[model samples]
Target: MKNALLIATACLLGLLSTTGASLPYPILPPLFVNGAPDSLTHFLGLPPKLLFALALMVNPIGLLLGTAVLGSLSDRYGRRPLLLVTAVGAAIGHVLTAWALASRSYPLFLVARFGTGLLEGHSAIVRAMLADRLQGPLRNHALSWLNGALHLGWLVGPLLAGFTIAWGLTIPFYIAAGALLLGAALVGFALERKPRAAGPSWWSVARERHAFNLLRHDGLRALFGVQLAYTCGVTAFYEFYPLWLVEVGHYDTRAIALVNVGMCGLMTCSALFAGRASRTEPMRRAAWLAACVALAIGSLGVGHLWVGLVGIMAFGLPHAFYNAVVQAWAADRFGGGHGQGAVMGLLSTTFCLANILMAAAGAVLTLVDTRLVLLTGAILTAWAANRMRAWGSGAMAGLPPAA
Candidate 1:
């Protein structure tokens, strides 16, 4: 029961943070491409696509940096303190984002987004807490719930923005900001810190044992290298699919939100089933799932209405399963002795880096056509699938050697 409560809290935090962070997905592009020109969208006379890409890139860059250290910090200082501190900072970031939007200050909005992403390392922190408590299938199940919560947040954030942007562009941001504070309160009151001996300062620990340290291992290096490519595919789809709708189907904010509901809703359901089949090797399953997801995502660039609908919705199944399989595999194989916070942080850092790479590349590709970006994602994921299968036989046979 206690474990259940903690997992629930972690899921809720994932929901809150992701929802707030993804608010701009359906809203921002239209603001740049279709809405009245403004200081934010037209900064320094750059094209709207470039400006929008910069906005998207800044946050993930911060996330990449923050995860590098925050996970190690939690391992030294305790999860509760790190969670509480970061939540408040992220909430403030939302408020700043709202203010920037209201004032048409693009520079400030970018700064706020970066700050929010930097402090939003709480996802890794919460996952680390679960890793500390649960093992094997229980931990895998809990991570699935957390994964579902994040997908649901992606659905809700755009849904909320789609509905409330009519009232004001900044309204959804304010609502998300308030929700973040509530999440912070929940953390402060509902969760208890596990007692641990404080060994060294967080900075010292962070400096020595950062997120990328795991990459020093040959097996883990190949694992994360595969993950980097896989995540690039995922981020490209997540960040640009709405834009794809806008360009191909002439989708408005409301229409884009409704479409996301279909896809992200499926993802939420699929997450429940993640890693449930114990007989299948996780790496093998992950390879199959990635191949399926690549096909689904690749099909969407064709622009047929039926193809778009089915492709968007069906891709969720394999994406969710793939995420769960990889995370659990990483935990079971590499999480011993090394802090789970650090391991989880490595995953988070890799994801943020993937996001940054895709966003930047997608911007340049979007200038020609969004289909090119989608195709690039599909190709990378297919390559990753093949690579993962190659490594599966050896990795499935044995546990990771010590760091």
Candidate 2:
């Protein structure tokens, strides 16, 4: 029963975190458009595209810093306390975001987003909590379910945002804030704090030096490399897909939301399936590679609306598989040892770094040609697939069996 409660808490928190994070995607484009009644350009005296890109960039920067600091804190202080604190911070951030939007303050909006990112750095903490409680196949399965919950939030968030955005731009923000607070309540009430053996100082374990050690392990290095490349591809694709739909496919916000729903729905299903199938490590790796290939093909072929939709679906389905498998792999590799929070924090930082780089590249490329972003994504994904294939040949020799 206790284990079940922990799993439930992880899933709920995952859903809340993802939903709040995704709410802005569908709503921001309209607000960022030049001459739109609610546009930020008049207030900020910056081009809409530049402002949009900066807005996207700031969150990840905050997340990078927050994950590093807060993740380590969780390792030292305790996951439960950190979870409670961050969840409250996230709620406050969202409230501030809503106020910023309501008052039409661009700078305040950016600050709020940064705060949200800082607080939402609970991913590593949550993963650590699960890793601490569950083991072996059960742990893998729980991670998969956690991944699914995230996608489920993504599937629902944009649709809700799109529909409610008509009521008021601030409405979605308020709703998200409320939901986050509710999640905080759930965590505080439901997740029991487990005592942990004292470990190394967070500062000692949280250093960049430790991240280098992950590369010393042959299997871990390959896995990390694959994940980095894959993240670059995914960040480019997801960040710019809305722009692509608007500019190239002529999709309105509602249409984009619908498409996102479909894609996220597929991704959620794929994550659940991958989680169940993860017992077969070889098969999971193969599926991951295949998914990358599909991402490349679909991304490269997205010229028209129908083709873009198909490409989106193709990429989205396998995207979850890659995430689920990689997360399970990471947990299996590092969860048993001391400083699991720090290691997971480092992993989260790597992904965020990739996101920051790819998102910046995509934003710049969007000015010249949106298709360039997709094409670049395709190439990167294909490279990741190739790397995975090579890594699979002998990488498993030193690695433990997948939990």
**Local error of candidate 1 at residue 260 (angstroms):** 0.7
lDDT of 2 by residue, 1-403 (tens): 3888998898888888878777877776655652364545555465677677777777777777777666667767788888988888988998998898888888898899999988887887887777777888788788888888888887777887888988987888788888888888888789666777687775765564344455666556666666677677777776777777777666666777998898888888887877655345552475465556446445544577677777777776667777767776667666556366766776676767776777788668767777887778677776777666555554455554433
> Deviation in angstroms for 250 in model 2?
2.5
Q: Write the per-residue lDDT of candidate 1 for residues 194-307, one digit (tens) a residue.
A: 777858766778789888888887777777888899889888888888888887888899998998888889999989888474677677778898999889889878978678
- What do the candidate models score in CA lDDT, each in turn? 0.86, 0.73
**TM-score of every model versus the real structure:** 0.95, 0.89
Q: After superposing candidate 2, which stretches have Cα over 4 Å from the reference?
A: 34-39, 42-44, 193-221, 277-301, 395-403
- For each of the candidates, the C-alpha root-mean-square deviation to the true structure, in angstroms, is 2.3, 3.2
Q: Which RMSD does model 2 reach against the true structure?
A: 3.2
Off by over 4 Å in 1: 194-196, 395-403
